[model samples]
Target: MEIWPAIDLRHGKPVRLRQGDYNQKTVFGDDPVEFAKRWQAAGAKRLHLVDLDAAKGDDPTANREAVARIVAETGLPCQMGGGVRDEAAIESLLGLGLNRLVVGSAALKQPDWFASMCDAYPKQLAAGIDARDGMVATDGWLETSSTPAIELAQDLRGRTENIAAIIYTDIARDGMMSGPNFEGLAQMAAATDIPLVASGGVTTYDDVRKLVQMQMPAAIVGRSIYDGVMQLEEVIEIAGDK
Candidate 1:
């Protein structure tokens, strides 16, 4: 299993929001690139980045630049999502050297377009399924949909060849540093044949261990590492990252 350290960028700064609430965010530092480098040095094999501003329908220019710098400096394979809804946005981010682009709202709202994108960019697109109580949330978790997350994952399973992974995030646990929703993740894993990248509420080595036990291909850890509730190196070691 791979452990990905997360960096949520808001206006070019590294920050994290609790329960996907923008009003409840904690800015970690001014330079997100430095944070990326820190994670890389700490033995992170890949990085998970989110553009908070973009996810909320704001301009992502600043965060885009920050992402570019991180890619140029750290040289770690990075996967980013937030406001990536169109071909142009996808091209722009891929041009920045991102290894994978995650699409959430777009995938839920327009499955055909998402499928076309997957066909166009094989192994470069990941479905970002952010959910609360098994229901899918869109537009950066500000709006919840009636669609069940497991159902969406099952639908996306048809395009598993093109889709790189499914990044399943439990919105309620995100940034809370409590623990990952193992039950929810397990349900998603069972519903889809595509690779599962667990996200949200990953706080301790035990959490990572359980995820590993669940056979998750990857797990994204955010607030816990930033808040020191968990150490990146320890979790990386637990994940057996080489």
Candidate 2:
């Protein structure tokens, strides 16, 4: 399993949102690139980035050139989502040497588009399935679609060519430091053959240990690492390798 240190950006600044609520925001830093470096220094091999502005469909975006520069300069394999809607966005990000692109709404709305993306960029596109109460959530957690997350993920599993991984985010516990939904994660892992990246909650090393023990492969941990509730070394140790 790979421990992906998260750097969620809002207006180009590192920010963490409570329960995916923009209003309940906590600004963690002014420089996201510096923050990425710190995570790398602390032994982060992979990074998870979210553009909060993009997630809300706001005009002001956080996934900027500066962030692409972080990838170019740091050379850490980074996966990012939020605001990446079209092939152009994916192209732009890929041009920056990004490791992978996490597409949520697009993948759910148009499976063919995802197929086309995979055909165009094999092993580069990742599907993000964020859920609340088991139902799939889209448009930055403001809208709950009729589809359940497990069902949505199972659909992703069938798409073999294009998808590199599936990032699963639980809405209720995100940024609350409660813990990740291990049961939900295990179910999704069972439902799909696609590599899964667990996200949200993730409050302690034991939480990571649980995921690792389950053999889920990868995960995205944010608040815990940022709030001193967990460490990169601890995550790395338990994550094992690959």
Candidate 3:
């Protein structure tokens, strides 16, 4: 399994929000590119980035610049999400050399556009499925839709050609330092054939071990590494990374 170190950007700084709540954010550092370099030095094969400000429909220019710096400095493949709602945004990020673009809120709010983008950017797009109690949450987790997360995964499976993976996140456990939603992940894995990248609540070596045991393709870790609850190198070793 691959362990992805998360670098969430808010106002060009590294920060993390509890349960996707913007008001409950904790700033980790002032320089996101340096943070990305630290993770890269620690054996990170890939990085997971989120633009909190953009996700909330605010200006994303700062975070976008931060992302460009991280990519240019680290020379490591990075996948980012947040306000990636249009073709121009996708073009801009891809032009910055992002390995993958994660589409969450826009995917749920506009299926046709999502489909078109998926078809347009094969193997370069990932569906960010953030869920609360198994239902899909959109608009930066500020709104919960009636769609079941598993069902959405299944639906995306039909367009597997365009999608690189399904980034399944349980909103309830996100940034809480809790363990991942194993059952929820299992259901999603069973529901779709696309590669599954487990997200949210992955905070310890044990959490990573369980994910490896489940044979997950990849997993995202954030708060634990930032808060000193877990070490990136240790978790990378636990995930069997060389």
TM-score of each: 0.98, 0.95, 0.97
Evaluate all candidate structures by whole-model CA lDDT and list the values in order. Answer: 0.91, 0.85, 0.90
Roughly what TM-score does model 2 have, to 2 decimal places?
A: 0.95
Candidate numbers sorted by lDDT from highest down: 1, 3, 2
lDDT of 2 by residue, 44-105 (tens): 88888887887789853446766787897789888888867898888887787888888988
Ranking the candidates on TM-score from highest down gives 1, 3, 2
lDDT of 1 by residue, 87-124 (tens): 99999999999999999999999888898899999999
Q: List the residue pairs that clash in candidate 2.
A: none
TM-score-better candidate, 1 vs 2: 1
lDDT for residue 185 in candidate 2, whole number 0-100: 91
